[model samples]
Target chain A: MANMIDLIEKSEVTGDFPKFQIGDTLRVFFKIKEGDKERVQVFEGVLIGERGGSNKRAITVRKISFSHGVERMFPLASPRIEKIEIAQTGYVRRAKLYYLRDLRGKKARIRERQDYKKGKDLSTAQVNAAK
Target chain B: MTMGIMATKLGMTQIFIEEGVRVPVTVLKMDPNFVVSKKTMEKDGYTALQLGFGQIRAKLVNKPTKGHFQKANVEPTRFLSEFRVDEKELANYEIGAQIGLEFFEGVLSLDIAGVSKGKGFAGVMKRHNFAGFPASHGTHETFRHGGSIGMRAQPGKVLKGKRMAGHMGDELVTMKNLRVIRIMAEENLILVRGAVPGSKGKVVEIKVSTRKPKALPGVGGATLEEASKNPMKASKAGAKGAGGKKK
Candidate 1:
């Protein structure tokens, strides 16, 4: 009886999603279609949290623009999302970084996490100093 | 009263179409449907086709219904619905004729009717959508009350059909003009763009919309012609195999 729902759920699976979590810096490339013309727009921000599951999973991205904090939540499985790039690794203690909204300037910064991968944004001295 | 079929609401989900737009669709699973009997003007003084759907065991069949199935020379089914058609269209169907999901192919929209979800013993706000008294301004226990029902002497008692709190839902509800998003004939599944009348797992009656859409390209320009054609006069393949391109 429920096989039809399972068939639709199977078709909606894109099958290509990288393991990126909350507190990770993300560069999302979204495809913008304006009538006949189409373009890719990039939004660089920190992924504060994620909710839902399966095809409905969404990412909440927060970025400080012009000294004003802006947060955008969108479905990660959206067809319009062209690419998702992890720009930085953040070490945090909580699942949702909503407390970052109350902090400002240097206080809003996320502590860098030293995972196995090398990041282009990290300096050689900074990487060695963490060791 | 037009051409219709019986299907059950499977559930709702989203699917990506050609334009990368995710359309919300309700999955409806219609197993093979058959024409059980025909009511004619000469016999019943009305024109309608009794369609039988859903698989049922022969042992579970009662005596009368089992006899009715035996007369039609078809297997027993659990559900039957009558679709009114013109007397002239009565000649199109014979008992034991098979109607497939392809019957809805090329149709742009449809109307569905079913029993809605039951809300037992609901309040006025939940039932009749009555605007209750203000919560503040020293309001007491009547926040969600039915409010004043009648005036004093002029009307004496409350007028008939006055909106009041009572049994809510579990009544026949029809949702009209739901867009036909896609039809998966292979799977016997039709994806409708919007919500149907009932919640999931409810048997719903699907009929051709009363309102005709503007400029929908019907396959072979045939709905009635194709449907009335003897199953052998045309290939039994689905709509895709037909000479018409998929819309």
Candidate 2:
């Protein structure tokens, strides 16, 4: 009987999103509607956390602008999100990169992973194949 | 005083509409309700349809209950409930027919009744929402007391129906005018807009609301299918033009 509830949620799940980890930097292209006109806006930030699962999945993105930290959450399955692009991957052991909030200047920088393009290539290739 | 359907409360979850706004919804699974018997005005002094739900094993059925099902020419069910209907409305249902989710087609709101979760032997503060004694200035061990029942000279004794608490919850509770969010016929699920009365898996009776209906969340009162497809016009974030930005 519980499977019936899952069946309803499964229909709303979006499968086109590219796979990205928590410490990776992503560029999200989001659609914004203004006065009968729609435009795409870019928001680039580090993926801090991913919450929930299935159709309710959301991602927390943290960025620094003008020496101040700004955090934003977006529903991963929302139709308003046009696309997600992995900018840079970081080598981190934590599931949530919250400890970076305390560090600033050079200390706040994330260590770049050497072999990150392989995973991004595979995920984007799979997304293209699905389309 | 109308026909209703019995369903099990599945759980609650959040679903995002097309406009990227999240809506909290409670899921209900509707099983097949078999019409076990029909009562007529002249024969039973009232008109009603006796519906049965859930499946029961053959060996667990008692003789009288088995004979009752045999007389109705229907398979035995675990639970049986009756819904009173108008004399003219009785013609729409038969003794052995099944009721489906189509019975609630075009309904925008519902009244769901079920037994609430039990909280045994509660105090006045928890049960009746009473403002108990002040918790300072020598108030000790009597913070949860129900203060006063009546005036000193007026009525002398305590009032007959004073609000003191003993048992709480585990009683029939009816939540009225819950907005219907979505109905998935193929999955046998109905998504209602708010919290229901009981916990998950509890059987609840759902009926069309008797109160006046409210306008749906959309421009010019669009239907649910139209609102879902064009959620920007349906949600408040879109209706506010440029000022109402959703986070």
Candidate 3:
């Protein structure tokens, strides 16, 4: 928590990442470099959990594919993360959506947040309304 | 043989690299250190450089240490350490010359010497990593204790240096071949990959490894040459100006 550590954390790439918490459906734009070629890959999933703070902060994203549950952990400060976009917000009380892994079909779906646009700004409100 | 500097442990932090690979680094603050004295073969029968680190008020220095600093014609420093090097390298440095993080700039690896965190009167389970008895049906308070001291009458007295419950840590520990991840000259911080001995704020001696890595042949001496050439230029160009003084 020293000033030097703070300075070091500030030097890392915070990029213009969308603010989305747990239970929110999000899409991450990750940059992948192969040799001299660079490309962007998009991963869409539900924000399950987030841990740590500052430069060490990481987030867990889970998505179901072919009836198999897949989870990925990504460091927020990583340079590979080009951007993040909140596709939709879901209504949930818990901070982590780990229980979603056990549920399948009808039990796994999260209800859409009704007041998502109430407190948000006009620009974000429009995006949420469009979703 | 290259000169060394004294630094303080500034806690650990993580840094993400180009490929999104996160590296855990232990930050060390190496303040501007001055050469207090040099030991020549003719005088001390060995070649070494005595360097001082950290600034202190002149009034706080004792008379003996004051006289020692007076002999070297330098300001009083809080920490002093001697680094043994070859006599040929002694001519490169003088009594009043300064050393900083620039001395570790292209250095990939180094040897760190410091006193590890003290855990006083530790038991065999914690100190020596001995597998204590498990808590089961008949296990009692002796579960955490060392099982037996001796076998039969074959060994009358306990063997010397036997693994037992005793003092742990608070000893001079040298971690060798620790990679130097990054050197922020402006912040006077050297970020090293993996952990080093000692806790935060503890003084640590950072020295170039005597055994040079085959991958980096001239890195040790080249780093020193770069530091000697620019002195405090890196600090000036970076945030912290000369002598680690924040702007």
**Best model per lDDT:** 2
Question: Across residues B38-139, which tens digit of lDDT does each residue of candidate 1 receive?
Answer: 999989999999999988788889999989988898888989889998888878888999888768755666889999999988988999878888989999
Cα lDDT listed for each candidate: 0.74, 0.76, 0.76
- Compare the candidates by DockQ and give the number of the best one: 3
Docking class of 2: acceptable
**Per-model RMSD to reference:** 7.5, 6.5, 5.6
Q: Any runs in candidate 2 off by more than 4 Å, and if so which?
A: A116-131, B131-138, B212-247
For the predicted complex of model 1, DockQ is 0.25
**What is the two-chain DockQ of model 3?**
0.39
For each candidate, the DockQ is: 0.25, 0.27, 0.39
**Every model's TM-score:** 0.84, 0.83, 0.86
Question: For candidate 3, lDDT tens digit of each residue in B109-128?
Answer: 78999999999999999998
Model 1 regions lying over 4 Å from their true place? A116-131, B212-247
Give a tens-digit lDDT track for model 2, residues B121-142.
9999999999999989999989
Best by TM-score: 3
Worst 10 residues of 1 chain B by lDDT: B230-239
Model 3 residue runs over 4 Å out of place are A32-38, A120-131, B211-247
